[model samples]
Target: EIYYNDTEAKKYAGNSRIIEIQTAMSERAIELLNLPNHPCYILDIGCGSGLSGEVLSDQGHTWVGVDISASMLGVAVSREVEGDLFNHDMGQGLFFRAGTFDAAISISAVQWLCNQDQAHHNVQRRLRKFFQSLYKCLVRGGKAVIQFYPENGQQMEMISSAAMISGFSGGFVVDYPNSTKAKKYFLCLCAGSAEMNYTVPAAKGLDEK
Candidate 1:
């Protein structure tokens, strides 16, 4: 496993080619967000090295970033995007107050939550917290665009159910076809509204005895 705190992860911060791809995708995603002309509060959940921040800033949105890895956030802060940065784990409830943001985005991060079959159960739990927290933090009619890798339909269905149970409406699911260099990517978008109660499955224990 690549240590997220390692220097190698930080090196990706300065990779122009990678940055270009991220920027392009972010721009397209933001367009789908359909933000108002006035400045809006935007959160980049699991933001790595501020690549999203760059694109959000360029688009004139007020952006903030949160990441679990300090080393990765260090590289993000070094970019000096005009927004706040926090060291945070998305699995935990968001610390912000209700209706704190207009929109939220998470890209290429949710798959990290899936480790094993039991771990996949944990992914559902974490995603429930994530969707609930995002719902609480977004104003009515606000949007959330999340891009994640789904191994198959089962995993994708789990995520979709979590979104609805977490109080989001008008869910949109899109599948990106596999490219020459990479596998397919899945994008899920949902509009936040009232809160709904959800019970996530618990992870199976390792001990057989």
Candidate 2:
């Protein structure tokens, strides 16, 4: 379903305004990840067109990316992005070895998993499996910042509840609560101790039209 438009894929293959928006949204998630100064490996979940991976590469961090769309991954490969790219349905769970990534980030992707496209496609089960794999893939202190748009309160609860059941330090950060265009919702999860707390930076100037 994500591979709905060839023109959109082609546009991403080159360079365009959509990528700019993706990059910007992903940057916010990366900031929430809060990696150390030294280099670390990252997992870019739903890393469409490699735009978010570009940001990670620019930060001097190595990364691996996974997406459900072959067309999108094709575009990413054409860009010669500095990361390994592969195909995977996140609902089925990631295939990474335990503690393989320092951190993980997903931009505007998780919400898609909520769609019940198939009779066997259970949303809650899928969400839990996704988070379970994510928790295993991350290092002891690794955190995942997923930026998503919830259609309603039910989705938000279901998603958050799944994360908690999977054992993520349960909390979500809201960016630009006042803004329309720039508002973002990040579900923050930590694989390590529950005592590890962070102060999500304020939305700041993201609200400006």
Candidate 3:
């Protein structure tokens, strides 16, 4: 399922509705930043075809896109004329220096790291590393806005708990479950904070006992 080249990536990007949804999500996430200047450095993790970059550009924000897919990155490079773009993996940690960005956004990408059975622990570890990198890459009071599809309540808890443990505060979670599709989408925003210790309750249906 890896999009290995520009043409293959473009096929997926041609779906206007999905592109619109990704754009909407990115716009909503950027709205929460309340940044103070033009040319703000915004990072789009898992950027594909520059859909999010298009929205950010419309809002006058300077953006950088990163993704592991070469095809996807190539598509992004074509469409994201207004911003810098990179090919990188989120799981390996961001390459930028501390305080290099005003905000970061991830759209519908995190879930690809692992599957539902191993998601709880796998996602937590990945997110912890992500948050740590995010913390270093963003200025004080900067924000990371992430959106993904979680299998259930337990998955959501794993994500929130990881944020808290990673020294991020002001945590917020939003869930939209589509019953017909049997899927749940989650959006989380966490702010960097001094305190790093917090516990998340065991999710009610986690073990299915």
lDDT per prediction?
Answer: 0.70, 0.84, 0.68
TM-scores vs. true structure, each candidate: 0.81, 0.90, 0.78
TM-score between model 3 and native: 0.78
Candidates in descending lDDT order = 2, 1, 3
Compose the digit string of candidate 2's lDDT tens values, residues 51-122. Answer: 999999999999999999888888888889999998899999999999999999999889888865754337
Q: What RMSD does each model have against the real structure?
A: 9.2, 2.3, 6.3
Which runs in model 1 stand beyond 4 Å of their true positions?
A: 1-3, 116-120, 173-188, 192-209
Clashing pairs in 2: none
Q: What's the distance in Å from true for residue 209, model 2? A: 8.3
Of candidates 3 and 1, the better by TM-score: 1
Across 123-159, the per-residue lDDT of candidate 1 in tens digits comes to 7888789778888888777777776667777777777
Model 2: number of backbone collisions: 0
- Runs of candidate 3 with Cα error greater than 4 angstroms are 1-7, 116-124, 175-186, 194-209
lDDT comparing candidate 1 with the true structure: 0.70
Model 3 C-alpha lDDT per residue in residues 51-134, reported as the tens digit of each score: 878888888888888887988877766664577778777766788998898888888887666553455566567777876787
